[model samples]
Target chain A: MRNLFFFIYRFRAFLIFLSLEVLCVFMLVRYNTYQGAAIFNSATTYVGYVLEFQSSVKDYFRLASINNTLATENAALRAELMKYKDIEQTDSLNKMTDSLYVVTDSAKALPYILHAARVINNSIRRTNNYLTLSVGSEAGVRPEMGVITPGGIVGRVKTVGKRYSTVTSILHSQMLVSAKIKRDNTSGTIRWTGGDYRTALLDFVPLHIKPAIGDTVVTSGYSTVFPEGVMIGTISSVEREPDKSFYTIEVKLAVDFAQLSYVYVVEDPHREEREKLERDAGIKSDEP
Target chain B: MNRKFGFINIVQFVLFVSFQILFMDSLILYSTAFCFIYVGFLLFLPLGISRVWILLLGFITGFTVDVFYDTMGIHAAASVLLTYLRPHILNLLTPRDGYDTSDTATIYAMGWRWFLAYAVILILMHHAAVFFLEVISFRDVWYTLLKIVTSTIYTCLVMVIIQLLFFSGKRANR
Candidate 1:
């Protein structure tokens, strides 16, 4: 007993370190559990309230840009209505009208594919850029959901709360988004090169695949995180080496990440079902 | 004599937290206000404060900030680390026997250079721990070192500027 006590006393700091390490490990292991995630949900709402008040003052400067966006959207809606009218005679008029009516009626169009949120807190200088959004889990946000603005794809949802969510911007090195060339079906993964926020590197495209500058890239829909057809960026440059098997393409993001503020969180209705299937498949494969 | 500063500390916490959540959050050009509060609280604790109190303060400050940022317990863990390190930092700089209870570690008590060194070291340590914790928080080690260095430098610079401005008022009065 004396020897044991002496041993513990000799390394008191080590024991403390061990205990703390254990606690941290426990917390980390239990992190994804519902209780741990719910805490962030509540905190985000509180933080959102504080940021909402602060942005209300600075929001004036954005009035002009927001007005321009609204005007453009309004004109596009009008054009869409005209196009529908021209095709109304040829197609099933009532079915087309039902689809068009939802968007044409301004009241129902308030919350569409993209939801607006004020940026409460944002960090860009860090290699892993994270932006705090005013919207949260209570607002229908979930982890792995894609966040975007009028400009382009911003990032993916890292965590969500009742009234706020943290978005990992495309500028982050960890952001791996699948994108495809607009002109051709060739697709590759997009990741930031850590050199410029305005540009990203597209990897895994074969050298045989032809790609051109100024070609648009959109989400490939492989991951349920983002819906198909969301704009990613345009190809700014392409590099091919004789020995290398893959062509590396440089993409200039469509969204001006530096000026990002308001954004939307996209929810994939099939995510839960998809995840369940993947998990079950893995378990069955391991059973043999 | 009553240790009347409890309410004052709470008020400071509220004000600093409010500043972080509101004004500093949206401003990507500068560091967030929570960084200031983290350093500010460290400066406010009286000389010879107990270790437990320091740990408690660190945990609360960090947990609250994490709650806002949606980072879970990362800030809390980092804050606790800062709190544990502050006394050691003070010990390293102003040896306990040499410190005067009435004089805080502000610029007035310690020269600008010493204050700068003190605040810079603490802020760097805090930011480094936070960046690493965040990286490990999700189990993704990719670009961990890069994130640590960049965020630490940015957070440290912002912290230094904020300390200079906020503590200068006290020095000016002195």
Candidate 2:
């Protein structure tokens, strides 16, 4: 025992350094993985509170722009409401003239639910950026739910807290959003090449599709996370690689990430049903 | 380790950690370089303190910053390595009269040339470890290296200005 103690004392500095560094690296690897990301992200209590406080202070500076956005959205909704009201009034008038006539399907207009959230902390410089929002599990936010703005798709929920949630922003290299060309409906995947936040790479698009520059790209609904037809970006450039079969396409993202302050968490009602059908189909195919 | 100096060290630790998280952290200059001045606290530990205790102090300071940065342990890992290497580095630069432990390891006490070399070396090691782990991929090796270099220079500049502002060699000799 004395020998062991002496040995440790002799090499105490190197030993201590090794252990501490090992512990730190261990924490880095453990938290950087997909599973334990929730506990270490900024959505935790103290940092959450501080960032929320800072955002609240900054939120006051941008109230005018926020109000403008709200007013524009309200105007669009009101216009749509007027059109719907005209149709409903016409239907009701016809129903009064002929008894037993009924109006159906208005209650099921949307397949997903949207919850409004304020982004408390946002980072755009990192290759894999994330945003912390004031909404969380208590607000019905959950992992894998799609997050978007009034303008375009944002990202998916990575981890949820009681009062906050972290979103793996679209700028992340690992993020793969199912995207399609609005004109031709040709599908591709949106990926970041770790350089530009305003631009992203569209993968798996064929050379023959011939997407014109400025073509609109939107979510294709292949993944249950995002409902179909949400705007992603507009094509900025396209190139056909001689060595590869697919076209190299670039997209200019619609949402200005630097100014991102508000988002809507999208809850897909039929996501579980769709995933279950796919799983059961896979099992049946495996039986052969 | 007189009780008075120990108490002063405790106060410095809190001040350094708070400065790092509150001020340095919020400055993301050009979206690449992040100046971390807290590492200066580890480098300037009272002379003759046990190397093991220095490592622990570095971890504690780094962990305080990490909790706010949400970087898990990247800062702590780099800090431990830098703190453990400080003694050997001082020995490498030992003057014939040897290190005067009377004054704290302030830039003013250590002379501008010696202190600049020391600060630059330690800051480079810390920044390299931090940015390498931060990017975590060799695919963008040049970019990560650029970030490391810029952040190190930025940190060293901040340390020099801080030392000139508050601490002076004449005062440290007391």
Candidate 3:
């Protein structure tokens, strides 16, 4: 017994090192996977507060660009509103004489609800990138909700805190977005292989379909997270490798991840119902 | 081994960690070279500190940085490896008269040549571990290699500059 104690004492440093390394690796593997809630992420209260403070300080420098994007988005929204106003006037005139029409819940008619949030912290250089948002459960942001900017899709919320949330950015290696070509409707998956933040690879695009450069890729809406027809990016390059069945297409992402400040979190109201129904039907659902 | 954790060391720890997660986290050069200045704090710890304490401190520091970086344990794993190898590297590069109890692993204390070799090897190992563990695959070997090499050089350059600017050669106890 004394001999064993001596042995342990002699190599205590190595033993400690091994155990700590094992613990770290355990945490790495455990938290690395897409799970319900993460404790050590930036969305934690203190870390979120610090990051929010830092972003608040840095935000001053980006006010000009933020204002520019906001103005452009406002103009686009105003034009869209004008078109909708004319449609509403004609529709209401027709419906005014029709007293037999049954009233329906407008909220139920809308499949998705958007919540605006400010990005407090973001990183693009890591293998798995994540963004911290200023809104969380308090603002109806929850896990698995898709995040998007006016330019394009950003990512999906991974975890949520009281007043903060963390998003798994589209730039993450493990993150895959179901996308389709806007022109021919050829469907594939968009994944970011490390190296460049502005680009990602669209896999499973069969070689039979001739995808040209500048072809727009948008969400397929096959998943419950992102709504269909949201812009992802344009195909910059398509390579037909020898013996490969699919063309390796590169997409230039629309949103500039580096300058991201404001984003909208999309919440699918009917996601649980659809998912439960699919689960009951024994159909496997794809991750967001 | 007998030295205690000073108030200055605690302050330095907080400063190093905060600076890393806040300022240095965003400062990436050319998209490939990342400046992990927090490694400097781990690298320049007092030589007299025990290996066990060093290892624990490394884990704590890396874990703290990991939280803000949202990488969970990658930083901690790399840092523990770095601290584990620190003593061995010091033994390998021992000076003629050996190290003083008050000596720090700084450029001023150890000279530019020794400091460079020490910093490069340790930083290279840490970066390799971090980048490889991050990707968890050998798929993008060339790009990962480029990142490790560039980040090592970038981190080493920054550490050296920080050492020169902040850490002076004069030891008050001596």
Candidate 4:
């Protein structure tokens, strides 16, 4: 017994080192799983407050550009709203407002809810990138909800605190967005393989589709995370390796991740119902 | 260490950690080289501090940095490895007359040559561990290697400049 105690005492430092390292690895694996709520992330109250304060101080320099972007977006939205209003007026003049039409329109209006939030912290240089937003559970932000800028799709909420949340950015290695070529509607998975923050790879695009450079890519809405037709990016390069059956296409992302300030967290109201129905029907629901 | 030195070390720890997360976190050069100046705090700890204490400090420091970076354990793992190897690295670079009991691992106390060797070796190990652990694969080995080399150079240059500007003056007064 004394020999055992001596052995342990002699190697206490090594033992401590090993145990600490193991604990870190365990945390890494545990917290990295999709949608897992981690207690120690940047969204924690104190860290979020510090980051919020720092970004607030830095936001003064970005005010002009942010104003310009918001102005342009407002102009675009006004034009879209005008078009919709004209259509509504024409429909009313035609007297085609049936009960079924009203039902469908109301159903469509409630599919997704948007909450505007400011990005307090964002990182694109890391292999697995994440963004911390200034809105969280108190503001109705929840894990698995989609986040998007006015320009393009951003990422999904991974964890939420009282007034803060962390998003697994589209640049993350494990993140997969179901996207389709806007021209042909051919669908594939978008994955970022590190290095460049501005680009990602669109996988499983078959050879016959013949995708070209500058072809717009948008979310396929195959999953409940994003609404149909949200902009992702445009294809920049397409290559066909001899051994592979799929085309390796690179996409230049639309939203500049580095300059992200304001975004909308998208919550699908029918996600639970759809998921439950699919689950009961024995459908796998693979896309996320 | 005296109470004054202990208090100074505590202050330095806070400064290093805050500076790292607030300023250095976003200060990447050319989207490739990252300056992790917090490692400087670990590298300059008093030589005679217990290894167990050093290990705990390393874990705490790295874990704190990790929390802000949103990489929960990668920093902690790399930092623990760095602290675990610090004593051996110091032993390997022991000067001809051996280390003074009062010595801290500052460039002002150790000569430039010794300090450079020590810093480069330990920082290289730390960066390699961090980048590889982050990537978790051999697919992008070359790119990861480039990041490791560039970040090591970047961190070492910053650490040296900080030592020259701050620690050198303090040592002269002593």
Pick by DockQ: which candidate is best?
Answer: 4
lDDT of 3 by residue, A1-288 (tens): 999999999998899999999999999898877566658788888889999999999999989999999999999999999999889987766567755655495435866789999999999888899999999787888898999998999999998888899999998989999999999999999999887899999999998899999999999988888988999999999999999999999999999999999999998888888788888998856655
TM-score (C-alpha) between model 2 and the true structure: 0.88
TM-score for the A-chain in each candidate structure: 0.75, 0.88, 0.94, 0.94
C-alpha DockQ for predicted model 1: 0.21
Q: Report the C-alpha lDDT of model 1 over A1-288, residue by residue, as the tens digit.
A: 999999988865445544544554455446533332344432356666765666666767888876787677679889999998889867775775445544664323432355667775665544456777888767777777788765578887766777776677787755788888878878888888564677898889888778989999998867766766778999999998788899878999888765665677876656677668878787422110
Itemize residue pairs with steric clashes in candidate 1.
A41-A161, A136-A164, A137-A161
Clashing pairs in 3: none
lDDT for each residue of candidate 4 in A215-266, tens digit (9 for 90 to 100): 9999998888898999999999999999999999999999999899899999
The 10-residue segment with the lowest total lDDT in model 4 chain A: A98-107
| C-alpha lDDT values of all predictions | 0.66, 0.81, 0.89, 0.90
**What DockQ results for candidate 3?**
0.83
lDDT of 2 by residue, B70-173 (tens): 57798889888888888888788776788765646777777888888888998999999888877777878988888888888889998889889978667677
- Every candidate's DockQ is 0.21, 0.60, 0.83, 0.84
> Candidate 2: how close is chain B to the reference, as a TM-score?
0.93
- Put the candidates in DockQ order, highest first: 4, 3, 2, 1
**Between candidates 1 and 4, which one is better according to TM-score?**
4
- Model 4 gets an lDDT of 0.90
